[model samples]
Target: MKIKSLITALAAGMVLSTTAVKAEGNAFRCAEGETYYMNVMVSGVEYWFPVYEMFKQAAHSMGCKTAYTGTPEYDVNKQIASFDQVLAKKPAGILVHPMNSDPFIEPINRAVESGVPVVTFAADSPNSKRISYVTSDNNREGAYAADVIAKALGGKGEYGILENPGQDNHDKRVAAFIARMAEKYPDIKLVARAASNQDPTKAYNAVLTMAQAHPDLGALFMPEANSALGAAQAAQELGGKIKVMNADVNGKILDMIKQGQVYGAINPNQGMQGYMGFMLLFLAAHPDLIDPMNDYKRASYNPMGLPVVDNGFAVVTKDNADDFYWDAYLKRRGTKGIEE
Candidate 1:
């Protein structure tokens, strides 16, 4: 019996030693004194900063470090500069939102070459060597908006497309919206298109201008939260005459819906995109779970698929606005209801 006990103890010690060795085998673990800064370069904060905030929090939860910074404007050069700055520190992974698709190719490639993992969100640089792009089905989102507007109108009338023009996701959304309108609802007329540049003030002015010019404009269609916010305010001022349907629901936008100003919004889970982007990078450092040689497993090589993950959205209307997401809305934007 004594000999048997000794053998069991020896076996347990061997197992523990092997487990320790396995744990120590990762060559890419962030050194004890090192930090894996996750650089998040997005277009602007006010519009989507909640997402970045959540990402930063998620990284902390996962025991990973991060840096969330972005240029206030949608300037590609500005975004590239942010990228360059983050790359200089040689971070563990990067979650970026390339304002311009074409300009980011070389910089993203440089990051990958330097052995840094990069993932993009909301938009993508498809031509770049980056591994993934995390965004929703933008084209589908546009198409969905088109269908909603058509059905709400019960056939057709003049409508306007609100977009940012050169942004890849906006371009795709507009194209899909128009295409769906042409194919499925041929009778619907997509009239004046306004480039709001994703700014609330610009969107407001644009919608007001278009509304004054095109008295017959039936509804406002948009894929951006800011544009939707502006359009809803305009339509509300005009007595909700034009049905406003759009994507990305913000706290203010939701209130408009409750008040019968904004008709509805396709709300995407921006938090999830950010949360996942950080995870991909954090996990990539874990060589045991992610194979370095496999391009699909690493964020650096798979950013093309990540920068635009289809973080889902749902339509919010007056009937369901109360039950929708008040708590999440308050938490994300750091605002409370008028009563609160």
Candidate 2:
């Protein structure tokens, strides 16, 4: 009886030990001091705050660390320099929003070659060796904005666009807006196109000039929030004759929407962009975590090669503007907005 009892106790102990080993092996938490980073140009912009908040949240959930780094300026060269500085830290991975696509190819490729994974959000370097791209569908957002503006104008008025010429995503938005207007609403004329370059003063002057040149201009569209501020001010000056719509929203944009100064906005799902971007970077950095039966292993490619991820978007109108307020969101979150 004593021998049988001893054997049973030893078997139970072995089973428990095996279970513990398996648990440890399967755990997804990060190693001590392992960190990931979110990098962008125009780092001080309000648009990036919500994004990094979610990225930080996702990292913390996985017992990992996260940091936000980038240049406050819009210059692509400065952005690349900041990216290189982050790379010098040898972080576990990075999530970057390249200001322009082509200029980032070499730097991104170099990072990937050095075994540091990179995932881009909001913009892309398609020719680079980055593991993944995460963003809303810019074409769809532009087309949708066109439809909204056209419908508001009753389909037979002139409209103009404020552009940021060099950025890939911004260019796509402008192109698709024009194309959609041409394809679906031939009666609506595109009378003016001006390069705002994301400058409020430029957008203000452009909108004012376009409205003057084309007295029948019923609507205006821009690809970003800053330009919208100036555009909306111009529209208000014109006694709100022109409806202003833009791609992204800030607190001021939401206020304008609420006050009927701006028509509406197509807002990207920034939280999802950050969360999924970090996940992609983490997976790319730790390719050994997954071993699905695929050709990636044989081809000497990273198993986590996700080419594009559409994080999705939302249309913000007066009805839902309150729900999108960044200040309200931060207050609910109980954290400093972007300071941490």
Using TM-score, give the best candidate's number. 2
lDDT of 2 by residue, 2-83 (tens): 9999999999999999999889656678989999989999888989999999998888898899999999898999999999
Provide the global lDDT of candidate 2 against the true structure: 0.92
Local lDDT at 61 for model 1: 58
Reference-based TM-score of each model: 0.78, 0.93
Stretches of candidate 1 above 4 Å error? 1-47, 286-288, 291-309, 319-340
Q: What does candidate 1's lDDT look like per residue over 202-307, in tens digits?
A: 8888888888999888898877777787777777777678888877766687788888788787665677777777666665445355444456644334422344
Would you list the C-alpha lDDT of every candidate in the order shown?
A: 0.72, 0.92
Give candidate 2 misplaced runs (Cα > 4 Å). Answer: 1-26
Quote the RMSD, in angstroms, for model 1.
5.9
How far does residue 244 in candidate 1 sit from its true spot (Å)? 1.6
Query: lDDT of model 1 at residue 325?
Result: 58
